[model samples]
Target: MRIVSLNAWGGRLHEPLMPYLVNVEADVLCLQEMVRTQGADADWLVYRDHGIELLQRANLFEELKAALPAYDAFFLPVARGDLFEGDRRFDSEFGLATFVRRTYPIIGQAAGFVHGEFSADGYGPHPRSRNAHCIRLFDYERGYPITIAHMHGLRDLEGKGDTPARRHQANALVDLIRQVKHEGDRLVVCGDFNLLPGSETFDILSSLGLADLVTSRGYEDTRTSHYKKQPRFADYMLVTSNVEVITFDPVAEPEVSDHRALLLDLK
Candidate 1:
């Protein structure tokens, strides 16, 4: 399977990213900070043109209610952030969101999108307190199937070592990982975990038997956040036990968001 994960930057994108089909896309996509209020056209366009299902909200949740009538929508309200790392708020003030392909019925749900309290602090002076989104995806139809955990955590905060919040933030996701993974079932975790390969969080996930897709292929894990020298490898496509990492690259064109798109293929 191949997956593409991005923060979406904001509610809107440039002309290039507006009609997302023109750009490289994903079979299943997870977008964060989508500021689509009720009846907004952002997700509607994806559904209209590409047939991708969406799960999100804007000023109100009415549009989500109507767009996805078959399945109930879940919201992870944006709250305060842990001050330990730093303080940065979502530009859209939205939480991480999931849009299950309408074809797949959900068997489980997360507590909410917001991991920790999000302090309304802008970046610059203090470190930015960032959290990630963890969504567990299941394919139960195949007798038994794989479980996917999608997340986007904070990266590059100055005081990461001193704070327990960053580690605690991943507790829920780690718990989800333990519960969903079984002997026969394959486990895959993707999305922007926000930590670099050498970071403690990355090591923790690795200790659990997960391998970074980019690292295994000998492809430099860089590219995602524009702030990095090269493209940063904050976004990840990791597999547990072991899975093939066929291809990984930043999209060549149809430039979607400010962050370069990372693509992954696996057997």
Candidate 2:
């Protein structure tokens, strides 16, 4: 099975991002920073916060569902706010999405907030709400169940560091994992964790017997050229020892999004 995880940057790089999503051919795709605007006819919307403005695809989630018809789509929103086109305002949801191949029978699932609960109003303060989604599927070929869970970790304006909220988020993630994964299941957890390498999030995840594939495999940069920030790492993939990892790549080419895609091929 091939699984790919990316922070899609709200599909801001629409031209390159659409084709990449279709061509990647991942059995499972986990995307963060996904946007959905209901009843909005416009193709693009703008999100403004603290003077920073970002362009987002009006409904990238539904677009991907159409583009990848073979996958079962799931969207979990952490917050709902207003997106704009000129002076018109449209209600939009922001969060994580997971697409799994239809051939894989989804036998179990779980989802919950890792930071703050769903905010119906505007996206609350920085370190806005974040949620995680987990799905368990029986891989007939592998003759065992595989559990995959992903999340867009809380984004704190102060910086990515070990803090009480982040620690609570990590524990919440582990709790969600425990709720869905079975004893013999091969476990995989991934997403744009928004965390630095030395953060305690990994220590908490390690307690669940999963190992970080990015750092352990010597991937120093996970951000694309579009992101001109320091400490380029923001995405990661973790798998249990039982998973037979055929190949893993922190794809740097194609420039699909600001954050690099983490691709893992496993048996």
Candidate 3:
């Protein structure tokens, strides 16, 4: 079975992303920076930030559902606030989303904040909360149930260095994983960690006996054309020792989003 992870970048590059999603045809897709409008179509919607920068987004959850009709969609919003489309304003929600093929029997699922609490005070520059979404599914092809958890890690705008808060966040994420996983269940934990190489966060996750596939495979970079100044700022996919890695690729050919997609084919 194939699993993919990507930071959708709010679907800012929707044109390329749409076709890429269709072609990849992954068994499971975990996406961060996913945006959703309460009651809106998947049309090109423009959100302006004081006329300085424009954020173009669509109802990505609905769009993905339409594209991958056979996949079960799950979304959890970590931030909610008002965004402006010219003179009109509308409420928007942003967070993580996981899509699993219908054939995969999902036995358990859970989601919660891993860094900071949800901001009821709107989405303006106040350290936004980050969350982890975990789903346990029976991989009929492999004959084992695995718990996969995905999260968009807290962003430290100043720099991507190891910080105390990040250490705390890592602990929180590990705790969330333990809550849903069993003693012998194979596990996969991943997402846009926003962490540099050799960060303490990796050590924290390693304590749970998870292997960081990206680092272990010696992949040096995961950024696409969208990220010019940032190098090696990438996503990750980790799995337990019991999981057999059939193939792993940090796909760079498709400039679907600023971040490259992580693909894992496992048994």
Highest-scoring model, TM-score: 2
For residues 100-153, could you state the per-residue lDDT of candidate 2 as single tens digits? 999899999999999999999898888799999999998888788999999998
Give the root-mean-square deviation of each candidate in angstroms. Answer: 8.8, 0.7, 1.7
RMSD (CA, angstroms), candidate 2? 0.7
What digit string (tens of lDDT, one per residue) describes model 1 on residues 114-190? 14455453222233343344444454453345555666565444533423545655565666566655665566666
Query: How would you order the candidates by lDDT, starting with the best?
Result: 2, 3, 1
All candidates in order of TM-score, best leading: 2, 3, 1
* TM-scores of all predicted structures: 0.65, 0.99, 0.94
Off by over 4 Å in 2: none
Clashes of each: 20, 0, 0
What shift in Å separates residue 208 of candidate 1 from its native position after superposition? 3.1
Error of 1 at 108 (Å): 2.7
The positional error of residue 177 in candidate 3, measured at the CA in angstroms, is: 0.7
* Candidate 3 lDDT over residue span 136-238, tens digit each: 8897776888999999988877777888888998999999888888888989898999988778998899888998988889898888876877557658889
lDDT of each: 0.49, 0.93, 0.84
Local error of candidate 1 at residue 82 (angstroms) = 19
User: Which prediction has more favorable lDDT, 2 or 3?
Assistant: 2
